[model samples]
Target: MSAPSTDLTQEKQRFELLSQEFENSQKDYSKFIAARQQLEAQLQENKIVQDEFALLKSDAKIYKLTGPVLLPQDKAEATLNVDKRLEFIRGEIKRAETQIADCQKSLESKREELLTLRMKIQGV
Candidate 1:
């Protein structure tokens, strides 16, 4: 009913909202980290494949595993496919990194806001 009580109630509501936001940011950050890790792993695997391809002779036979069958494939085609996949994976990695950085910044900002709100609530 009083002004101080009303201010305190508002502060408490703000704190609750901020807490929820912080939790959501944390979850997003975690998901981005996992995605980045998986992308890194894929990048590593693709690099290895590229290296192996480099060592193979131009006339070397290539077989692509399609479902349960090993279908004969042209070495040049396979190499091109791997190169394209590497490019795609690299782009995805960059995107994931950006998302991760953004999420991290958001989390930090939310944490500071939440801390400040908590202090304000306690003071009230």
Candidate 2:
């Protein structure tokens, strides 16, 4: 029932909440890293596909599979499809990288806040 005991209890609660928030931010950082890595991998694969497409003969045959049927496709169309896919992948990679950067910034802020909270708790 003492004022000091009540203040101590409140401080402890705040410290615990900050700790949980910091932990969640760390998890978000990990997820962002993984997503960025996956996007980079996809980008690399698409680049390789573009390179291989460039090496094909002018009259090379292209086909698209549609449920067990190989539908013939024009070389120009195939090239366009690859180009579009590469463009999309590049955009996704950029978006993922931006998200990773944002996540890092947030994590840094949370870390600073957690440090400040810890200091306050200690002072209390």
Candidate 3:
């Protein structure tokens, strides 16, 4: 093969590889976005739980959901559990956001490379 044909083949291979990487990254970002949304929903529900627990009287009756049964549970402990869950969800949200940002940066960079490669191929 001529030098130019060989170079073109290599560039074409690189272009396909980069395209696949872009698609994979896009899928990862989509998954993270869905996870973040789910976490946000859980956080909202947990907030409602926190509010409900806060409004309860110290002596008010509460129940823990044991499978097939509502077992009596301390109000304070339940409130604390809900608070912990909310904090955990908040941390997850922050992490997910960070991952999303990184993924976006990678995606954009790969896109620019793809565009350059396309132009290169066309010029050849």
Q: Write the per-residue lDDT of candidate 3 for residues 11-124, one digit (tens) a residue.
A: 999999999999999999999999999999999999998888888889998899899999998888888889899999999999999999999999999999999999999994
Local distance difference test values of all predictions, in order: 0.92, 0.82, 0.94
Residues 1-124, candidate 2, lDDT per residue (tens digit)? 6997888788788878878887887888788788878877887887887788799997989888889999998888888987998788788878878887887888788788777777876884
Clashes of 3: 0
Q: What TM-score would candidate 1 get against the native?
A: 0.96
Ten residues in sequence with the least summed lDDT for candidate 2: 115-124
Model 1 CA RMSD to the hidden true structure, in angstroms = 1.2
RMSD of candidate 3 to true structure, Å = 1.2
Worst 10 residues of 3 by lDDT: 74-83
Q: For model 3, what is the error of residue 76's alpha carbon versus the real structure, in angstroms, after optimal superposition?
A: 0.5
Off by over 4 Å in 2: none
**Deviation in Å, model 3, residue 105 alpha carbon:** 0.6
The TM-scores of all predictions, comma-separated, are 0.96, 0.84, 0.96
Candidate 2 Cα deviation (angstroms), residue 27:
1.6
Give the count of colliding residue pairs in each prediction. Answer: 0, 0, 0
